[model samples]
Target: MNVMIFLLLSIICIGLIFIIHKYFGKEELYFLAIIYAIVALMMSFKTIKIFGIDINASIIFDSGIIFILYYFIRKYKYNESKKLMLSILICMLITSMFLITTSIMIPSLYDEFNFSYQNMVLDNLPTIIIYPLSLLITMSLSSYCFRQLKEEEDYRLIKTILTIIGITFIEVLIFIYFSYAFMIGFKKALIISLNSYLAKVILMIIFTIFLNIIFKVKKVKE
Candidate 1:
């Protein structure tokens, strides 16, 4: 069931990204990328079991953001992708600030929901801050790596696979260490980081292959 849901969400996310890019143009694609990043950050707090391994649910949306970055870097300029990354970073900073302030506010005596809201936000505050920071770092490194690989036309697929693995591993290490190491200990956090990297690489590979097929088909049609 977890595997099935993961695949379904991965397909939906990849499909929506290409569809928007196909019909809407880069401006809208940028908007969608920002939304994907923010949603991924918010969803990072929930873990789901896939093949008995625990992984964050946000991998689906994170894969979407990665595809957007890859698409822009492959088809447009690296600077354009940088613009998208900057936009996401700014938005995430604003979001974290808002969440922190809201979570710290005292609820009124008659309030029925504010406490729960505060608890949820404060509990996941580490993720709220860490997820985006990790994502931005990954985006920066991945974009640069992809840009370099762009010149290697003979090994596109191999380079793509390596880029995904390398970048996602970095992201998992940073996120898991800072977010979980203190609470769960270094050894447990390292184990979870490895699992998360595996899960992310799987999702990213699926998304990247699907995206390549879509663009190749469109190119053939054109």
Candidate 2:
């Protein structure tokens, strides 16, 4: 059930990427990337079991952000993807600030959900900080790699799959180490990170295939 939901969300996100690219413009893709980055940060606090292994629920959106970055790099310019990355970072920082401020605020007497919201944000403060930093590093790396390989038309799919695997692995390692290791113990954190990477790699591969198909179809239409 969780796996099904994960795939459904992945498909919807990938579909939206092409839809925005086709109808809207690069500006809309930037908007979508920022929205996904914010949602991914919020979802990092939640964990779900897939195939009986624990993983962050944010993987779907995170992969979407990467796909959008790759799309920018491939179709637009490398610098444009960097602009999108910086935009995402700025938006995420603003979001983190908002979460921090809201968490510290005293709630009104009638605010029933304030405690839960405050606790969730306070408890995951480390994650709020670390996740974006990890994202910045890994996304920089992913974009650099995609830029290097973008000119290779024959091996595009293979190179993209490999790049996603490498980027996702590093991202999981950095985020889980900084955010989860001390709190959950190194051993448990290692296990969860490995599980999370596996899930992310699978989802990324699926996104890569769909994205390639979209590009091909668009090329044919052009």
Candidate 3:
């Protein structure tokens, strides 16, 4: 299935996240989670063709989800919001990837790989809502942890969140660029691949800078 539209949309979403980050910085992790959902929703849809019943396992445009999920697991423990929230994101990312890959590898015994917007709406709407709630819970825990640690640093949560999200976005941009570069179908492939990587990287870096400023402001306030 041709997922060009979804790819375009995902890149746009990344850009939107950067803009949002510039204005509202403390919610960096929360915003990143939302961006992941939007991009993943499309990739998840495109991957449905390949994944079958486990359509949720697929990753469409890139692999940023891996880093976010991993960082969450490694950083926080059961009591920690960052750790728990990241764990949930990790589970969803993995589950979604599994669903997508299984569909691709296995013959379509269950669902079709249409990758329509309606399909994504039906499948991911609930998943998306669920993530934010989980994020909220995680955020609460993080607040507690920070208070306990009493870290003098300003925007402690914001910085950590931005760092995690930024790194993940960067990793994904790399994966997508490399994946496309190797898959030589024609000249357009290289052009598309290079453009995709550059756009995402630039957007992510911009968000990081904005996030840094947010942190600075928070520290000053403290």
TM-score on alpha carbons, each prediction: 0.91, 0.94, 0.36
| Runs of candidate 3 exceeding 4 Å displacement | 1-38, 41-89, 94-174, 178-187, 219-222
Inter-residue clash pairs, candidate 1: none
lDDT of 3 by residue, 1-222 (tens): 334654565455445444543454334545465466555544533322221222222232233333233323333443444554554456556655655555345344464554443344445444443433433343444444434433436775455555545443443334332333344344543454445444544444444454345434332111
- Per-residue lDDT tens digits of candidate 1, residues 146-194? 8988888887887798889888888888886678675557887777778
- Please provide, for model 2 over 99-123, each residue's C-alpha lDDT reduced to its tens digit, 9 standing for 90 to 100: 9998899889999999899989988
Clashing residue pairs found in predicted model 2: none
RMSD values for the candidates in order, in angstroms, are: 2.2, 1.9, 11.6
lDDT of prediction 2: 0.87
Q: What is the number of backbone collisions in each predicted candidate, taken in the order shown?
A: 0, 0, 18
Best by lDDT: 2
- Model 1: lDDT of residue 40: 83
lDDT of predicted model 3: 0.42
Whole-model Cα lDDT of every candidate shown, in order: 0.81, 0.87, 0.42
TM-score of predicted structure 1? 0.91
Model 2 spans with C-alpha error above 4 angstroms = 219-222
The residue-level lDDT of candidate 2 at 44 comes to: 91
